[model samples]
Target: MSRRSLLRGFSGLGTAGALAALTGCGVPAAYVEAGDRSAADRSARDKSLVFANWPLYIDTDDKNTSKRPTLDAFSKRSGISVKYTEEINDNDEFFGKISPALMNHQETGRDLIVISDWMAARFVRLGWVQEMDRAKQPNVAKYLDPQLSSPAFDKGRLHSVPWQSGITGIAYNKKRLGREIKHTSELWEPSLKGKVTLLSGLDEAFALLMQGDGVDITRWTADDFHRMCDQVEKYVKNKQIRRFTGNDYIKDLSTGDVLACQAYSGDVIQLQADNPDIEFVVPEEGAELWAESMMIPNLARHKSNAEKLIDYYYEPEVAAELAAWVNYVCPVPAAREVLASSKDKDTAELAEDPLIFPDDAMRKRLAIARDITSGERVEFAKRWNAIVGL
Candidate 1:
C-alpha cells in the first residue's frame, strides 16, 4: 500500500480559493491587529502545545495506532505534552477556519500548524504568524537546508520552517513506457498523446511545464506563463493530454491507465515500494522543490511550547526517524548520515535513495520556483482554470 499527501483535493481547493480571494491588498482589515497579536506566554501554565497538521504526515507505529514515537519522545524529553490534531487537510480551508479568530486578534487555539509553503507565504505576508526566536532553535538554524533558506516570502525563515520538503516531477511506469524519461518535453511525444496528465492547480502545474519549455522558474515571467498556457491549451485542443488531474494521477499511473504525470516526490516514493517498476524522474530541465511548512499562528496560546516542538523535530535523530517513514526530501541534511548509520537495513537503505535524500547533483538541479504573488494569483488562476477546466 502506498500513502499520498492529499495534494490534489484539499490543496487545490484551498490554493485556488486562497489565491483568488487574496489580491491587491496590503493586508485585509480582517487581519490580526499588531497590538492584539501577542498572546501571553502560557507555556508556564499549560506545559502543552496544540499542533494542527495534515493527515498521515507524521510517522506512526504500525502496531500501535495511538502511539507516535517521535512525538512521545518529545513529550518525555521536554515535559511538554503535545495535543496533536490532524485538522489541516487543505490550506485554504484551514485558513478560512482560523482566519476569523486571527482577524479579530484572538487565539485560534492551535499553537502550531502546517501548510504548504506557497500558502505559508500568504500567512507570513499578512503577519499572521510570529517570528521564531532563532536563539531557541539552534538545531533548525544549523540543519535546515540552505536552498530552503531565505524564501521570498520569509527571508531567513523568521516566520516559518519547513516540516517536510518534496519535489514536483514526472513519475512514470518504466515497464509500461519501455524507456526512461529524461526530460519533461518528452511527455508530449506522439506516442504519449492522450496518456499524459498534468496537475490541476496552477501553482502545482505551471512550474514544471514552464521548465519543460526551458524557463528558469525561479524568475519566470508573466509572458513565460502565457507561453506555457498557450502550449497546454494547444495540447488540450489536440487531446495530446489525457486530462488535467489532481493527486488522482497516482491511481491512474499505477493501474497503467495513464503512463506518466506531474507528481509529488513523496507519493512516488511510496509508489515504488509497492511497484518497483514505477520511477520518478527529475527531468533534465529541472523540477520544483517545495515544502509543507510549520508556522505559529498569531495569538496562539502555547507559542513557547510550540517553538520547542518545532526545534525538537529538527534534531537529526528525530528527523531521520521521520524521513524513514514519510519518505519526503529530508530538510535536515545531517539526518541523511543518521539514517545511513541506522541498524535497520530497510531504514538504512532509505538514506541512499536519491528521491528521499537528493544528492548534491540532484540538489543543484532542484529549484524552488518563485511563488505566485497575491497580485498575479487571480489572473493566473483564471487563465489556468480556463485551460484545465478546473
Candidate 2:
C-alpha cells in the first residue's frame, strides 16, 4: 500500500507566496493570461538545453566534480546536449533572481529548473511554468511515484516532477537517551524533556505535531493547527522542548546537547555516516515527505528536449544512478531493485536502508499535509512564528 504525503509547504522561506502575498505580485488576477504561458518549442532548432538545479543534487564523477555522467549519457543517447548549472542554493534567492523575467512573461533564459515543490507552487499559480506534455514523457508517467502526483499545488503534476524526495522525521542519540522514541509524543517524555528540540519553521513543525495529535494530516484543519500550537507553547513554557531549531538541530544532537529532535531524513543519513549512534525514525504517528521538483518555466525555448530529459531521469536505471549519490528517498521505487543488484558494496547497502527505501510499515506512517493557502499563510505564519519566536 502507498503512503500519504506531508506538507507541500515551502522549504526555506515561508510559503513561496510571501512575495505574492505581500505585493499581490502573482495573485490570480496578476497572472499572465493562460494563452500567454507557452513559448514556441524550439528543441529542434537549438539542440541544446539548459537546466539549473541545486548543488550536489545529481550524479558526478568522484575525481572530477565538473563531470556529470547521467547528463552526459542523455546527451549521447538523445543527441540533445545539456548545459547544467548548480546555481540555485536557496528557494527565495533563486525566486528573486528569476521572478522579474517570469512576471514580465518573458523567458527565464533557461529551459528547466529544480526547486522545492512549495516554491514550484508559486510558479504554477503565477502561470510561470508550462503544462508538461505527458505524451512525450512515457517514463515519467510510468515511474513517477503515484503519491507525489496531484499535490494541491500542481494537480496531476502537470507543472512539476519531483527530482528527489526526503522525509521530516525524528532523529535521536539512542545511547544518550537510553531509549527508542517510537512516536512524536515520545519527545515530551519526562526523561527527554529539555533535551528535545522541534524544528523552528512553521512549515517544518506543524504537520508532525498535527499527526501527534491523532489527526489525519492529509485533511488537517486550522483548529488542529492552533491546538498543536497550544501544546508546543506549553512545552516551551515548561522547558520540555529545549528550543525550536532549524538544521542546527543536527549539531546539538551530535554533541549530546539534544537527545532527540525533529530532523530531515537526508541529514540524519549523512550524520550517521560519522556517528552511528544517531537514529532516525518515522514516528508511530507519522512524518512528512517533501520533494524539490523539476519544472519547465513558461516560454522555455527547449520544452520538448526538456521533457525528454525529465523522462530520461525517471527511467529506473537513471534514477538509481542519481539516487546512489544524493541518498534521498528514491522517488522511483524500481530504483531500489537496481541498487540492490549493484556490484558495489556501498551502493548495494543503500538499497536496504529504510530512509532511502522506506519499508511497507513505515510507508503507512508517512503523510503529505496540505500546503497552507496564501490567505491561511498570513494567519498561520503569524501564530507559528510567534511560537517559534521568529
Give the TM-score comparing model 1 with the true structure, all chains together. Answer: 0.95
TM-score of each: 0.95, 0.92
Leading candidate by TM-score: 1
Query: Hey, what RMSD does candidate 2 come out at?
Result: 3.9
lDDT of each: 0.85, 0.83
Model 2 per-residue lDDT tens digits across residues 40-134: 78899889999998877888899997889999999999999999997886676788788777777778989999987766877888788889999
Q: Considering every candidate listed, which one attains the maximal lDDT?
A: 1
Global Cα RMSD, each model: 2.5, 3.9
lDDT of 1 by residue, 1-390 (tens): 323447653224454464335533443435544565677888988899899988888889899968899999999999999889988766778887877567556688888999888888878766788888889899999999898988877889998999999999999999999999999999999999988998887777888998899999989999999999999999999998998886789889989988989999899988888899999999999999999899998888888888889999999999999989888998988999999998999999999999888988898888988888877887887788788886
Query: What's the TM for model 2?
Result: 0.92
